[model samples]
Target: MSKDFLEHKAFVELFDLHYGNLVGFVYGYVRDEEVAKDIVHDTFLTFWNNRKRLDLSYSAKSYLFTLAQNYALNYLRHLRVVEVNEREVSQLLEAASDELAEYDERYARVEEKLAQLPDKQREVFLKCVVEEKKYQEVADELDVSINTIKKHMSRALKFLRDELQGESILLFILSNR
Candidate 1:
C-alpha cells in the first residue's frame, strides 16, 4: 500500500469495514470473545505498521484472514506444546537419576544439531523451543515479522529432521542394546 493509502481516512475505512468480520473469523478458532477481539486488534496493528510494504494489488481481505488464521494456529500450537511439556516434565521428575543423565545426553545431541543451523535459525530455534518464548515475542526481539520467524523455524525443523534421520535409527539400535 502506498503512504497515501495508509493515511488515517483510508486506514479507518478499512478497519471499520472488516474489523468485526475478522474478529468473528478469529473467534471460530479461539472460541473466546475477548481473545478474538485482541487477535483482530493485533492484526490491524500489524497491517498499519506494515502498510507501506503491503501489496496493494492483492485482496486485503484475504491477507487479513490469513494473518488472523496464522495467529490462531500459533496460539493452538503453543497450548498443545505447553500441555505436552507439562506431562513430560511430570514424568521426568518421577524418573530416576540415570534417566536424568540420559535426558541430558539426548538434549546435548539436539543442541549439537541446532548448532549446525545458520545463526539466525539457531537463535530462533533455541529461543522458541528451548526458552519457550512466543513467536511474536521473538519477532519483536529480533526486529522481524512473525512470518519471517515462522519461515526460519520451518527451515530449521526440516534441516534438523533430515540431519537426524539416520542418527535416529542408529540411536534406536544402540539404545535398545
Candidate 2:
C-alpha cells in the first residue's frame, strides 16, 4: 500500500471503530435506522475507494461522519422530490377524472334531449350533424327530397338549441358541425 493510503487491516480497524458512531450520527439526521446504516456503509465504501486521497490533517472518523451526513441529506432531498412529483401526478389524475365525469354527465343530458325528438327529426339530426353527412346525401339515404331533409334538419337544430339553452358543451358540439 502507498504511504498515503491505509492498509486493509488499518482500514478495517477504522471501520470497526467508527461504523456504529457514524450510523448513529446519520440516524439523527435521517430518523430511519436502515437508511442510516446504509448511508454509513456507503460512506465507508467511498472512504475505502478514495483512500489514496486521504488527508492526514483531518481525522478519518470526522471524514466518515461528514460523508454519511451528505448521503443522508441527499436521501432526504430525493424523498422530498418524490413527494412533490407524487402530489402533482395525483392532482393531474383528479382533474382528469373530474373532467371525464363532467363530460359523461353532459353527454347523458344531450342523449336525454335527443330521445325527446320525433323519430324523423332525430334520424335527420344524427345523419346530417352527428354523422357529418351532407343534406343531399341524407335526403338520398332517406328517399326524401333535399328540401324535406333541410326542413327536418332545421327543426331539429332549433328544438335542440332551445332545449339545451345555456349549455356551452351542446353549443360547442353543434357549432363545430
Candidate 3:
C-alpha cells in the first residue's frame, strides 16, 4: 500500500470499521477523551504514512490498536513524569527561604541545563521554552515543521529532567521574567 492507496475507498472503509472501537479501547488507557481520540487519529495517520511498509500478514485493526496502546503508554509515562516533576518542584519552592534567590538560582540553572542539550534540541528548547516563542515562529525560524520542533522540544525537556534530577531548583525557570 502507498500514500495513494490510502486514498482508495478501502482505506476509508477500514477506518470506518476500526476507528470507533479502537478509540474506545484507547480511552481505557488514556482516560482523557480528547487525548484518546487524538491518539487514535495520530495512529491512523501513522498507518497511512507507513502504509507501504505495513505488513499484510497482520490485521490492520491489531496494528492500529498496538500503535494506540504504545501512544497511550508513552503519553501516560510523560504525564507521570511531568506530575512528579511539578510536585517535586512545588515542594522545593516551598522549601525556599527567599523567592528572589530561588528564582535567580533557577535562572542560572536553566542556562546550565539548556547548555547540556544537543544543538537542535538546545535551540528548540531555548526558543520555545526560554524565549517563549510560538511553535510556529520557532518552526519558521528553524526551517522545520511545527511537529519537528515539538519533537525536539520534547526530547530536550526529557533530557533536561534526566540530567537535572534531584536538583533543589527546577530545571526550568517557571517565572514570567
Candidate 4:
C-alpha cells in the first residue's frame, strides 16, 4: 500500500506473478494471443506510470485486472472500426469493377456497330466525330461536296442511334437513376 510497493523490485515481482494470468484474461476478450499479450504489457506500463495515483483501497491485482480489461475492450472497439472500414472499401472496389466491366462492354458494342456502317458513312463519321474535322475539310480530303459529307455523317449517326436505342438507352437511364 506504500509507494515502495510500486518500486522497481516489487513491480517486477508483480509482473512475474500476474503477466500470464493477465494475458489469459485479455485473450478471453480479444481472442488473439499476440494482441492479448500486447494489451497486458500496455496495462502494466499504464499501471507503472500512474502508480502514485492508484487507489490504495484496491488490491494491485484488482487494479491490474481492471486496466487490462479496459485495454482489451478498447482494442476490440478499434478492431471493429477497422473491419467496418475494410468492408466498405471492399464493396466500393466491387462496384467500381462492375462499372468498369459495363463500360468495356458498352464500348465494344459501339465499336461493333461502327464496323457495321457502310464504308463511306463510316469514313465520314470518323473524320468528323473522331478526328474532329469540319465537314468542308472532310469533303476536300475525300474530293466530295460538303453536302455529301453532311449526308454521310447524318446517315451514320442515325444508323448508330437506331442500333443502340433499346438496351443501351434503358441501361443508361437506369444507371443514372
Candidate 5:
C-alpha cells in the first residue's frame, strides 16, 4: 500500500529470512538450541522496535549479527548462574542419598545380627526391643516362664553387644533402639 507500510513489510521479511541462521550462529556460542532461539527472538524484537532509527547505509546482516552476539553473551552469563544452582542442588541430593544409604546399611547389619541369634532368643528380643513389650507381657504371650524370658533376653543383649561393640556407632544405634 503506502511506502512506510511496504518498508515495514520488507523489514519483517528480512528478519524472517535470517532468523534461522541467527539462531544457529548463537547456538554455536551458547551450545543450547532453546537459548539460541530465545536470544534470536529477543534480537529480532529489539531490531523491530528500533526500525525507525535504523541506518540503512549499514548492512542489516551486520547489525543483526552484533545484536545476536550481545544477546548470546547475556544468555551465557545467565546460564552460569543456573548452572551453579543446578550443581549445588545435585550435590545436596547426592549427600542426602548417601546418608540414607548409610542408614539402610546399618539397619541391614542390625537385621543380620538379629538373624544370627537362636530362634527363641530372636523372637523374645524382637518382642522386647522392637515391639516394645515388657518382660512379663512377652513371657505371657510366648507361654514361657518369666525366668526363661529373662534368660533369652539376657543372651540376646549380650550377643548384640559383643557383635556391635567394635563399631561404636552401631552400639549407639542399638542402644537407642
Candidate 6:
C-alpha cells in the first residue's frame, strides 16, 4: 500500500478511537447532542486540514476538546444574539398590537402552524421571521447549509400560505408588518 493510504488509514483509526470521548467533551460544554456532534465533526475537519502540521506529541484528545470548546463558546454567543433579537421583535409586536390586531391574529395562526414543523425548520423560520436574521446567518448559527435554510424557509412559507389562505389580506399585512 501507498504511504499516503497507510497514513489515511491510521487517521481513521485515530478518529474512531477519539470520536466518542470528543463528543462527550463537547456535550459537556454545549449540552445538546446535535450541537455536540456538529462540534466534534468540525473538530475532525480542522484536524484533517492541519494534518501535515499536527503535533503528534500533543494528545489528539486534548486538541479535539479544545476545538470543541471554542466552537461551543461561539455557538453560545450566537444564541445570545438570537435571544436579543427575539426580545426586540416581541417588544415591537407588543407595541403595535392595537394597530396590527388583524395582522397579529394571522401571524399567530401562522406561528401555530410553524410549531408543527420539524425542529430544524421551525427554528430556521422563527429565526428568520421573529428574530429578523438573514438566512445565511441562521444557517451558520444552525450549522446547516444556506440551501438547507432556503428549503426550510420555502417549506415554511408554503405551509403558512396553505394554512392562511382565507386570511390572505391579514397574512399580507402581517408579512409587511
Residue-level lDDT for 173 in candidate 1: 33
lDDT of 5 by residue, 1-177 (tens): 998999789878998899989999999999999988988989988988998898969989999999999989887888899999999999999999999898888778888888999999999988887777899999999999999999999998898878867543664465466
Give a tens-digit lDDT track for model 1, residues 59-165: 98888889989988888898899999999988878786777787667656766877889999988977887677899999999999999999998998788778776
Residue pairs with backbone atoms closer than 3 Å in model 6 (clashes): none
lDDT of each: 0.83, 0.86, 0.83, 0.87, 0.87, 0.82
Each candidate's clash count? 0, 0, 0, 0, 0, 0
Q: Root-mean-square deviation of each candidate, in angstroms?
A: 25.9, 2.7, 23.9, 4.6, 4.7, 23.6
Could you tell me which 10 consecutive residues in candidate 4 have the lowest summed lDDT? 168-177
User: What's the distance in Å from true for residue 41, model 6?
Assistant: 0.8
**Model 5: CA > 4 A from native:** 2-7, 13-28, 31-38, 46-67, 166-177
lDDT accuracy of residue 145 in candidate 5:
95
Clashes of 3: 0
- TM-score-wise, the better of 1 and 6 is 6
Question: lDDT value for candidate 3?
Answer: 0.83
- Leading candidate by lDDT: 5
lDDT sort, best first = 5, 4, 2, 1, 3, 6
Task: Residues 1-177, candidate 3: write the lDDT tens digits.
Answer: 785665666789988999899889989998889999999999989998998898969988889889989999999999999999999999887778477686677667777877778999988877786688999999999899999998997898787777767662454434244
Give the Å error, residue 132, model 6. Answer: 38
lDDT assessment of candidate 2:
0.86
Candidate 1 — which pairs collide? none
Name the candidate, 1 or 3, with the larger lDDT value: 1
**Predicted structure 6, TM vs. truth:** 0.52
Candidates 1 and 5 compared: the better one by lDDT is 5
Candidate 1 regions with alpha-carbon error over 4 angstroms: 1-6, 94-177
Deviation in angstroms for 60 in model 3?
A: 0.8
With candidate 1 superimposed using the best TM-score fit, by how many Å does residue 149's alpha carbon deviate from the native?
A: 70
Q: Write the per-residue lDDT of candidate 4 for residues 59-78, one digit (tens) a residue.
A: 99999999999998998999
- Estimate the overall C-alpha local distance difference test score of candidate 1: 0.83
| Winning model by TM-score | 2
